[model samples]
Target: MENIKFIDQNLEKGLYLVSTPIGNLADITIRALNILKKSDIILCEDKRVSKKLLDYYDIKVQLFSYHKFNEKESVEKILEIFKKNKIVSLISDAGTPLISDPGKILINEIEKNNIKIISIPGPSAVTAAFSLAGYSDDYYFYGFLPKKLGERKKVYEQFSNLESSIIIFLPARDLVSIIKEMKEFLGDRQITIAKEITKIHENIIKGNLDNILDKIKTVVLKGEVTIVLSSEANKNKDQNIDINKEILDLSKKMKTADLAKYLAKKFKFSKKEIYQKILIFNKK
Candidate 1:
């Protein structure tokens, strides 16, 4: 396609940061193919995955492991090649390198060594998830979810009251438990689960956490999941909510505290936090 123009134009210079498909191999871009075809070498998270993709396109460019474990070690060898004025492309197992993947160290090394860098940006699971899930662009990406519970809480506290979407990558095995935890901790905040994207089983489920958890249990999900959650909607409730008016409105049919709790849940805040703020704000 016309997207290959930039690659041909700059084929002679720089460290090419190539992006590959997250799932479907057909998703690879022409410019990325051109860079890989002309590259001096490729650094990959896994040699086998890169080899398979390279084999599909019949690209004979050499590839070597440059993931987290051996990234530091590869830096010297990579810099040595850069000295020869040869361009290299860095790729990961899936998606773009250094985007919640490896090759970050190598990129840093290339820049530090003053090797010019050019990017062949393409398919990214993060952006794909957002597009397929209809997620708001105003968001924060955790890159990947924390496996540890304590770390999760500390992370949750940082974004608990913010007003933007939260996106996280999770493996299939941990999806259920993580979804359950979010529901229990964050209330009925809207969440979208995009699974097996671009594959035969590709699916997207958007709804409250509790309902989404039930749906997953019914189906045997077999791949990575992209989680997106809507942030607080009616932000600045105390300042903007018109406390007396809201209390009067909902109180006509529901208890004041209960209605406050319900409204708080809708915004992904805890009932205690909302009620306490309401108590103080009303007093003031």
Candidate 2:
């Protein structure tokens, strides 16, 4: 490996938002490494997690614990470090800082005090998964879903009607239940699951919601997961039919099963979906 020289003069006295690798340590940028090497202090979610990366390149610096639990308390101390004209760098356990990570409070304070802040961009799981998912160019990142079932359901409902692709982070344990709930509220749209991104176990599973739910049930997943849901717009345009109105008018004469069969043949959607819609429409 070539020795990359660190130029201390290039970095200014300010708080640097450094983006670390999402999974593969080598995925980090040269500029990010340089910033970390030159920083006076490094603020991170977990010192143990950050230490591994720092140890890899032999970049020794003070690692301060700065996470959601202590964000408010850490802000004043960080500002104090700034007063001494020290170069501080804030990093998350993985990926970019403040993108579902801590740092917003400190950033707001830095701006209020007129302190300089710089961003050193690098690898991000959100963009990585989005790029590989092969969904629409436009997307809405919904970060992590709420732990509570009711709140999670509300979130699904909120984005159920959205036209663009949806990106969400999920823990390995909650993957099965969450996918089941998604099918219930979001319908059977296409989905892509990016697991353990950039690592040896990295896997991308793509299929319709119904098929994905079945596939996921057989396998056990670990590490971080990023899910990309294809746009409702794409499904709508592909079918190009007002399913509600069609079900209402057709049900006036035909039985539920017969109507479902008729619509299933005429459209791209599944018979099970049409049957459910017919039942729901008639009950209303």
Candidate 3:
């Protein structure tokens, strides 16, 4: 499907997993807009919240509240409509459905009933943050942080070891605490915190846990935050290198200690290891 092109054709009369903008109003794709506009009935997290977007675009389709708390009932209500052969569209307050949201139940129900699910993808904060992070793209998506510290630590450790970039959705109130905990669990890990995505005051703060704390010290951090962290091993920095080449260059006129220091600075390693390598190379 082309970007910014509206879907003008007839869609199957079941469920449409429509993606909305994570941040930046313009991020919404034409396909998503087309689906939202053409849907017979729209299921949203909040009627008022979704209405703002719908009304802004002059969408007058039927809107209803369908969220985790009311999902069981909503499912039955939705099924009633589906039986009538009406096409239903599901959207979250922001971003794609089922990412820290409860739009998946309807999708599962539709699948179980042997109905089809049409997907019209749109912008995601996870994607937005990663693109601007200036970090490696290989990553995983964790919808949200665990409520308990132990559980969160377990999750954090796993990501830290893999050294893969991670995207986490966090409540505004818990943002500072979560960042602080991340600092303790993982040392010197880089993070990019994006807040109020797409809307004004959209901020992407990039730094280590401690550095970010300092940055947000005087500022009032409102709105939800999507935390994007660099992998445990940052590839942009000189962590991985050819030790053979390192030794070859060190053997030429530089003392082991000096060479080790130089290599250590370039590649995030201790000087002692490089120094020993130099001695071993010098002996040969």
Candidate 4:
């Protein structure tokens, strides 16, 4: 065992974005423990969830709830603490703060006020999933697919044709439906599903979209999930396709928004870009 030094006085007056473990409590760094132990107040998404981690490590710091609903109300009150040169730390219920989590608004205010902000980085699901997936040299990450059907379609469409692997964080419950939908848009592309990463029952499942869908039906999946999608191998290569002609043909049958969204997902271009092109073609 190694002796770890816990720094308290060096914890300067500012906002500390501490990264907590996604599943395993031992994944947390010694520095993060020090900051959490010494900070005047720890702003967390949920006090109940955060308490489990705090109690696990014997950290008795003051905890406060600052989730999305109360975030607008808490900004100024937190800034006032910063003005008094008090050390404040912000953490999500799991993983790092502001990664598909609240704290962006608070961070903006902190920077605007010119108060210092420190990052005590540690475990994150994105990197964890990517490392385990081993699909590509590079990848695109979409944290939590959109809830609305149209928006979700657009998200799947946007990444459908990407050469790089797509990493996403989604609920385990929606796994079956999401895969069925992805199969429609993305075909039987290979994917790796990392469930409850770093925890005791952590399971990583890998197969094409079709097979994994069947496999998941055998068991009930609980807790959070991270998915990594391998790039399409042979079909829908963008370079050989005619964007203008596809747009022209689809425009005849589809609404402008729908066509833009459809083609946006089919090609590498964005919806806004495709929409503008369709508008220009309409002018002719």
Candidate 5:
């Protein structure tokens, strides 16, 4: 094999936030490869995971483990590396670092110290999944769902009325339960589940919420899943009318402030909207 020579070897002394391939190794950018090769030391969430990528390219460099568990403690040590004027690069196990991945503490410390922080953009699961989702380009990424059912429901309720598509990360094992909760709170909106994106086993499933639930109920999903939920604008008009009627009935019995707060959570209306409606109803 011919020796691979990277261009732009004169990398500045700073912390580099490098983006790795999310699933398919070949999906990585050439610039990202060049930076990784030029890095003096690479900080990764998992050394074992990063090793495979490093080994594949025959680029030997020091690998340091800097993860959520030890991020606080690792800050001083990382800053010490920067003080040495070494080229330090941070990469997550996959995708872009700090997108639902750890690196905030170190970045904050680096910023305070006035150390340069550079970004080497590449493959990101969030953008990759969304590109294939076929939903509205206007979307909001809601990282990972909460573990507790109540907490997860609160998240769903909070974003239930968002007019743009919602993208969320979920473990395959909990897909069924999460889908059920989404149906209960978000109604049967269109959904797209992108699994193992860019890999050989990559699968894209598109359907309404109810249909998606029924399809995946019997099957087992192996990798982490990215789900895209259609915006509230796609919901049935009759459903919104029913919720409005319910809010009006509650307004008759509950105080303006109390009804506004309660209905805001149960329905999609803003508290201010509900409050104004209650005031209007009381006048009649």
Candidate 6:
């Protein structure tokens, strides 16, 4: 156990967005532990969830509920604490804050008051998944994919053309369906699915979309899954594409959404961005 004397007693009166362990309790850093122990107040996404982490360390501080629903109300209270030069630490239920979690709005409000913000970074799902997903020179973090089938397909379509790895957080319940759609839109692209990372039942599966689909057909996933799709799209992408000519030819024959999906897969451009272009072309 690390001593509390290591913690800086002079921590400024501001918000500290601290990163907690995603699954394993031991993954918490010494510095992070010290901050949690030393902070005057801890603002957690959920008190029950955060209590587990705090109980494990036997370090208790003033905890307040400041999640998405009541963040607006919490801000004024947080500011009052700051005025008294109290150290405030913000932590998510798990992993880092503001990554598919609340804290963006709170941070913006904190900055308005010229409060000092510190980052006590530790464990994160993105970096953890990437580490297990093998080597990829470039990667894009899409956070969470759209829940609706139509919107999700468009998202898969837009990113399918990228020559860089794509990372996404998806519910385990929707894993099979999402993988099926990926196979349809992204072809047999290689992917890595890391689930329950750092936990006892940690599973990391890596294969093409078809391979994953077949393997997951029988098994039921229990936890949220983080996916990493390796890039193998095109070595010579958009080099032969004449944007205007292709738009002119396809625009007349295809619907706007269809055209956007087709062009996104073909040119490696964003489906949503291409759809915006299609709208302008129709007006013209």
Alpha-carbon TM-score of each model against the true structure: 0.83, 0.86, 0.79, 0.80, 0.83, 0.79
Q: Which model scores highest in lDDT?
A: 2
- 21-90, model 6: which lDDT tens digit per residue? 9999989888888888888899998899999999888887989998989978778888888999888899
TM-score, model 5 to reference: 0.83
- Rank order (by lDDT, best first): 2, 4, 5, 6, 3, 1
Candidate 6 segments exceeding 4 Å error = 1-8, 233-284
lDDT of each: 0.75, 0.84, 0.76, 0.84, 0.83, 0.81
Q: Please identify which of the two predictions, 5 or 6, would achieve the higher TM-score against the true structure.
A: 5
lDDT of 1: 0.75
lDDT score for candidate 2 against the true structure: 0.84
Q: 4-88, model 3: which lDDT tens digit per residue?
A: 4555798778788888876566677777888888899999988878877777666789987898999887787888888899988
Off by over 4 Å in 5: 1-5, 236-284
Q: Write the per-residue lDDT of candidate 4 for residues 67-110, one digit (tens) a residue.
A: 99999999989988787888899999889899999998999988
Q: Which is the leading candidate under TM-score?
A: 2
Per-residue C-alpha lDDT of model 2 across residues 147-197, encoded as one tens digit per residue: 899998778767865789999998878888888778766667889998888
Q: What clash count does candidate 1 reach?
A: 0
Cand. 1 TM to true fold: 0.83
Clashing pairs in 4: 157-265
- RMSD in order of candidates: 4.6, 4.2, 7.1, 6.1, 4.7, 5.9
Query: Weakest 10 consecutive residues, lDDT, candidate 6?
Result: 232-241
- Model 5: per-residue Cα lDDT over 132-246, one tens digit each: 8777769999999989988976787677657899999999988888887787666667888988888887878888876787677656677699888888776667866876687
**For candidate 6, what is the lDDT?**
0.81
